[model samples]
Target: MVSVQNRRIVFSFLLLIIVVFSSYKADSECDFKAIYNFGDSNSDTGGFWAAFPAQSGPWGMTYFKKPVGRASDGRLIIDFLAESLGMPFLSPYLQSIGSDFRQGANFATLASTVLLPNTSLFVTGVSPFSLAIQLNQMKHFKVKADELNRAGGLHILPPSNVFGKSLYTFYIGQNDFTSNLASTGVDRVKQYLPQVIGQIAGTIKEIHGIGGRTFLVLNLAPVGCYPAILTGYTHNVSDLDQFGCLISVNKAVKYYNALLKKTLSETRTELKNTTIIYLDTHKVLLDLFQHPKSYGMKHGTKACCGYGGRPYNFDQKLFCGNTKVIGNSTVTAKACRDPHNYVSWDGIHATEAANHRISMAILDGSISDPPFTLNNLCRS
Candidate 1:
């Protein structure tokens, strides 16, 4: 239990640290030279696909017109954000070919968790590129980039000064909760939240130590509302909320975000000249789910891809773009013709249209704590 004084400090910091945004592009004089991203598939440009040559297909069809590494049908929140900032899409740190890291590098990968998994990727399908590992990779990137720049490879990597001028974005932690939900249960998941939150905080501090002054830490989305979760969990009708999402799982996500926010608040006081903005991902995502029509989405909760029909369109085994022999017939989980109409792309991630809406909320300051946008970061 925190002391009353410590709790007060946390609350004050939240108000002080999180602030406003007027517009996405018009007020875009916020001159961030580059962006270094750390997260799961939510922001992964191509790390996982580059690492593992999976047999899956038909991703990135909406925008990229090919499998360009994102789990969604097209660009993610990170892509929209980069475009808003007038920066090109960040190249994945793991992708070796045709990737230009002069602007930034994306260290995020699919199925990545905050904590390092005990099992290997082959055994559990969880990414080995955990938060700590991403941190190490960032550290190494700085060292190597500096070396390359000194060795006349200026065009290959950004200048050393760009590190301090970059925006460090984190869209991780969702996978951490989702992967453990079925295995450990919500109560057990709650018990480990502090460690998870601590890892997130510690990563921020480490980035600050390495000259990262600006950060965008995102809270977990409503895990209960995810089609994958809804399909996987054993919840009766009474366990669901009005939107047909599991109340218990969302409650756990709230608890996790609360802890995350408290820790981020404290992080602000510890770092000097640092600006940390914790995105209220739960609120934004829940709001998006509640009013899909408001965002011009047709299916609020159903996934646009996957095997299972209706409700969620998610199957644990038969994933999106996957073709397998299911007892009698060879079934393929293909994407819907109108991917833009969906809130969920694969029952796990948001569609490109939904990603744009989320980015809009972030940049427009509706979900910001102090009602400020990236433009305010320039003032801070």
Candidate 2:
């Protein structure tokens, strides 16, 4: 015995309820509340300096106004990614003071390789914190978190909830290639790439074994495009790529990326109900170098902070923000006036500005393999 007006009102109310519920479900699906990262200096927050503690001024002048152990002048790819997810910057696992694990942790360190100790042929002094060690540290963190959750007084989410729901990101393999290239010539390195990638794949599988359902794996950037590589390596004029980068070195990167993609595809099939997004960082970086004006970059081929002349402006003897005695004269490595206009921060790492642009593309899923962007992967 309801009036016609009452019937219409009830229908509208039901429609609103359905819409609200759908929106909530969508938000929950995309709500990646935590993030765990692993890699080298490309993604290291502070793990390297936590152990060595030698970083100083102008290293973080762009954003932090002081040295913060980041290899770059400001933030890193992992930092921007965390910010995009509305999470605070991840604390380096080794950092003791003011560290917050509620969001997640960064286990990356400078110059970390995938190969185990005594296995890397190119790298000289091996650190104890390799990818395997980082994974072990992650396991320890999970155990501690689980204990706290069981205690019921101070809980940082159950380890199961953290690993199962959080996003696990990796930006490794560049150092692996660099180390191998330095020790064993290019041909030998190429021969060993498959084994190296297999080890990387095995590590990913280990993470998968642990409740890790989501992965954001970034492939190697164009290593030849790095000013340090260009300055150090001898390249034939005919072998230079369109961007004047070392063609042979870049070819190796392409080969590695292809193998990595294939390995990830096989992994996807093996690990059911998992989301894996392979980010094409090489292409993105090449595009940036090719069209520097488009990204507001003026010095795409040079280090923003170094003591050297043009073309690369990078020095092997003087690292970024370092002062060295050249012929008994103190020559200091100075930072660029406008770091935002430069792509390479210190001949190796990307500037915060560059990382921001790359991160935006990643968030929108523009440069990801299979077109499943970070947003889509998290929400799906």
Candidate 3:
């Protein structure tokens, strides 16, 4: 009994409703306004030097004019992640100058671990800014942000929005393995992994308790493949894996990663409405090592800045820089002409080029776990 005009009007209304719902869904998926990072040197923008202030030149030659507290030559994975999100590079919480905490803060520090400072495994000695301390700092930052929002009359997010909508990233645990392996053996490290993962889980629960709903947890990379670890230890031919990496250490890394993934899965279940993503950085790094040409890397095993040594072109005493003391002799770590072709900047961290590739993969979901990519999580 309806007129033709009424039928057309109803069809147009239905179409408009569909378009509006779709737009709403898309907006909800990609509305991350801030990022908060917690970990060690791998993600530290400047927290270490803010506390120490002893680091010097040839460190930030690739990007910044001088050492900016980043352990690498240039930008890190955290930097690249922020760039992808169209957010400013996060300022280290300890940094006092030119800081724009409107996006969020970097609570990571060099040599930080999931364990408490009193633990025997913290090789760098007892640091005041442990992960627990960093968590506490985040709490303080939230309160300060709230105060600023109220006073300045700026349109910054409220405390609830800041934590709830922000992306929380953790790139830790390598130091724990390294310290433990050096102090205690591999078997002991393996046995202690449960406690380590438990601590990580506990930290996540604490953050969730404080309104953090989204998390991106990067698992341990191939620590055995690091030039520092490679040159530091004396290993038999059997100890080396096919990739010329330490076999036992890599095996331990795999075990730790597996346990970490399982733990995150459980944490995700326990925390309702939470998004916990376990990024497979190991797989990405291993792929780059196996097929360096694919990523435009010419030297996968060698460090870009070091005394060019055999097998891995890395010298333990002569780190990445113009000068270092090698067995009482002041030796210079000659920087490579083309760092872009190399995967590692120093003997430990990835070069900016490598970090960029890894970050792109993470954003595009190539290296992320299923059902959650950095892009999707930010949008969601």
Among these predictions, the greatest lDDT belongs to 1
**Displacement of the residue 179 alpha carbon in candidate 2, Å:** 2.2
Tens digits of lDDT, candidate 2, 7-108: 999999999999999998777755576889989899999999998989897988889999998988898888888877778889999998778888788999
Model 2: which ten-residue window has the lowest total lDDT?
153-162
Residue-level error in angstroms, candidate 2, position 242: 3.0
TM-score of 1: 0.89
lDDT per residue for candidate 3 within 1-380, as digits (tens), equals 99999999999999999999999876775567788999998899999888888888777778886788998778999998888777888899988776777788899998888778677655655456778888899988887777776676444334446678888999987777887575577888898888878988898999898888888999998878888788886788899877778888889999999999999999999999988988998988877766778887788778888885767878765677757665778788877878888888887888888777788778888766645666765531
Residue 359 of model 2, lDDT score? 82
Q: Which predicted model would earn the best TM-score? A: 2
Query: What lDDT does each candidate get?
Result: 0.86, 0.82, 0.81
TM-score, model 2 to reference = 0.91
Error of 3 at 358 (Å): 1.4
Candidates in order, TM-scores: namely: 0.89, 0.91, 0.87
Q: Alpha carbon lDDT of residue 135, candidate 2?
A: 91
Shift in Å, residue 218, candidate 3:
0.3
Stretches of model 2 off by over 4 angstroms after superposition = 1-29, 153-159, 376-380
lDDT of 1: 0.86
* lDDT (10s digit) by residue, model 1, range 148-245: 88888757689989999999999999877878688778997788778889999999999999899989988899979888999988888999988888
* TM-score pick, better of 1 and 3: 1
